[model samples]
Target: MSRRRSARPAPRPLRPAAERIVDKRDGQWFVRPITGATSVKTYTCPGCHAPITPATPHMVVWPVEKALLSADAIDERRHWHSACWTRRH
Candidate 1:
């Protein structure tokens, strides 16, 4: 008797260094590139007090540790201009 063949392909492996969240002395920051596939959203930059236009590449940052709840922290996340964020150092 002939053996039945598998129809599905093998699953791909996950990358070890694919994490986007970074832990610093202040808090945890999520870093990611704005891709064309993503829908854009407008945000005000805390550094420059200017609006971050949609479809523009930028950075999203939030504090990891806070007295408030996790939901509050997520809501408080800010989108910043790439240059503005870099100058914060």
Candidate 2:
């Protein structure tokens, strides 16, 4: 007997998190929080120089100026551990 496949709609992609501007001693930045549910890819945290594994909550940050004029702003963004980003001077 042949089995029939059931029809199911694909899961919708998560909407991007709301971004906030941060003022640091170095410069202004555009920051967004990444929730565990939406965190899929592994990334390196520049602050701690460690790997941010999938499903781990983190922060995505980039220079405001770079983000404003760059077409590849997403590529310039870095994923950082929440605590590390907070403690960074």
Candidate 3:
């Protein structure tokens, strides 16, 4: 028997996720069509210049109890696997 790959349609990437700005104060994410200091910028990977997509840089600020904490727990940049992120490095 031959194995068949799952045939699911590609999901539409979130517009804001594709282009976003995050409010660290409230852990809220704002989608922006333009690029700014706060907006997450997509760049070419240093190793291969392959385009890299990083989810908007956001801080976890929710549930009240978790407020006032440092910005260290958010895994905001995992869109690209390590191999791709550091391919050139």
Which one wins on TM-score?
2
Cα misplacement distance, residue 76 of candidate 2 (Å): 1.7
**Rank by TM-score (best first):** 2, 1, 3
lDDT of 3 by residue, 1-89 (tens): 99988799889774542544444454454332323334365755434556545553322111222334545434232233335432312
What TM-score against the true fold does each predicted structure earn? 0.57, 0.77, 0.22
Worst 10 residues of 2 by lDDT: 66-75
Clashing pairs in 1: none
Cα lDDT of model 3 overall?
A: 0.40
Model 2 accuracy (lDDT, Cα): 0.90
- Tens-digit per-residue lDDT, 1-78, candidate 2: 999886987898978799999999988889999999988999999998999999999999988775555786566888
TM-score of 1: 0.57
Say which candidate scores most in lDDT.
2
* lDDT, candidate 1, 7-48, per-residue tens: 988888844332277765666776554542342777788989
Residue pairs that clash (backbone atoms under 3 angstroms), model 2: none
Which candidate, 2 or 3, would have the higher TM-score against the true structure? 2
